[model samples]
Target: GKDKPTYNPKKERGDVVVVLNAAHVHLTHDKWNTKLYRWHTGYPGGLRSRTAREQWEADPTELIRNAVNGMLPKNKSREARLEKLKIFPESEHPFEGFPLVPFLPKPRLLQDRGLGWALPQHLALVRWCPPSLLLTPRGPGLGAAAQGFEPANPERYRFRLRTSPGLQGGAGRPVVGIEDLLTEEERRALAAAGQQGV
Candidate 1:
């Protein structure tokens, strides 16, 4: 973990060290083959193109440096800024002199966690329940118990209510249950309150 120097033209030039582990860098499917690096030799018909895989095979350090340079803002200072970028093919580097403080990887997507990734065991999976499903009459003496409302079950909360025979609603309107969708705990609570669920 190297410190990135602040860009200030007036102040003395500083160093920004960027260390990359080429072995661990993950690229999306087919990008290794499809992504191409092109450059010209400052002459007619001197264009050349090579896939990322080929470039990495040829020189991994240059490949990493080029990738990082491409992400930097294009300006007169771009070259100066790129000069500060130091890439290493592997984790080995001469950064032991500084107090290395490893940074936590900021995962932007599910795939960013790498293959077969998952949340920590201590973290609980939260299931969001719609307010309507948990709503109860708020009038005096009419709490959740009186309204026969309970926490929705993760398994059955999203399913459509079953239709009963000989019970039909308007042609366009659909008939749905109000309390029958409750889990066993909810039904037990309703039974305790002497209220029949739908």
Candidate 2:
């Protein structure tokens, strides 16, 4: 009697990857004609070669398998890891009985051109702190207020700063007139210190 292999989730290190529509894989430029797959047939002058286009036409799954095999590390565990990969030329697959989770990429952040407030030369620093500690003080500001400081105002004080370019076109140079964390008294003191070259 042949023994059926049982799956143990705790023992497995990687997930079973199933790729469909292997035939429709796009090859950039002239790779379809230029790329060649060579193999030996274990006989005298048994070396054989096939173009990528010919290989895809004969067995599309093999094309994908070769690509994935090349990408994998050249180690002893490579064969075992490759066994988990299942490729289908078409959308049809036998793994419908098992749960399949589709892969989704994470959303990209908005670039400087996409954001109206963001500039090409300026670096934007956006920080979101708890409202209780800085904005709405039930008793007193435990952190900032305790140090004799508070945000200028709830509406104006948004923990966002834009840094401009410094001398020699270097980044991280702080620009003035956008201070949101200082009170009127603190601003006056800072202005007096600046005038006195402090």
Candidate 3:
């Protein structure tokens, strides 16, 4: 599988080997942009960062190797196995006798950034501030409202936190009131907009 931890022992079967392209494997969109590839020199304060976009541009094989390296157990056995692995950028791989079985792509975990839909407050938390900084107002509610960075956009990522009662119109689902959820300033802004809409 592309970018998946795997082992295919050709010696078990009668002299057959599988060679993977290791270059053209597709990474999920945005993963190749935001995901960081890191390394350390084992010295004091030594860390390196490389984006997937950069890796794909420089050497796609390196990206595949790094991804596979992370999956192997960190020990002498792993080192030996890793040394035997051969990755190439071109379409050809150096395995003969056994037919090359195409490595199927692995299903990606959705633990990435867009995983907000799993929770109500998750996506909503992005509206006012990140969860790490969520706090009660310092002085009054107005100060907290002022500190808010961005207006909550329900349309942005299908934000499904608390919203207006009539927000969806006639199914007549229990619509939460602005007074119940919003701060004074936020309620006033929403009210003003509704007036303008009218």
Each prediction's TM-score versus the true structure:
0.47, 0.48, 0.40
lDDT of 1 by residue, 1-198 (tens): 123356466443765665746543334334566789999998999999998767767876776778878897677767877777767766578876877444322212112254444433211111112222222322112233223333246345333322321122323222233243444554444433332112
Per-model lDDT: 0.47, 0.53, 0.46
Error of 3 at 43 (Å): 5.3
Top-TM-score structure, candidate number: 2
| lDDT score of residue 49 within candidate 1 | 94
Estimate, for each residue in 1-198, the C-alpha lDDT of model 3 and write its tens digit: 223345344221122223244454444324555789888988889898887767767776787678778897776555565666677765455565545544322222223255443333222222232222222222223234334344346475244323421223223222232243335664455434333332
Model 1 lDDT on a 0 to 1 scale: 0.47
Error of 2 at 31 (Å): 0.7
| lDDT ranking, best first | 2, 1, 3
RMSD of each: 21.1, 21.6, 20.5
Q: Cα lDDT of model 3 overall? A: 0.46
Q: Candidate 1: worst 10 consecutive residues by lDDT?
A: 121-130
TM-score of 2: 0.48
Candidate order by TM-score, decreasing, is 2, 1, 3
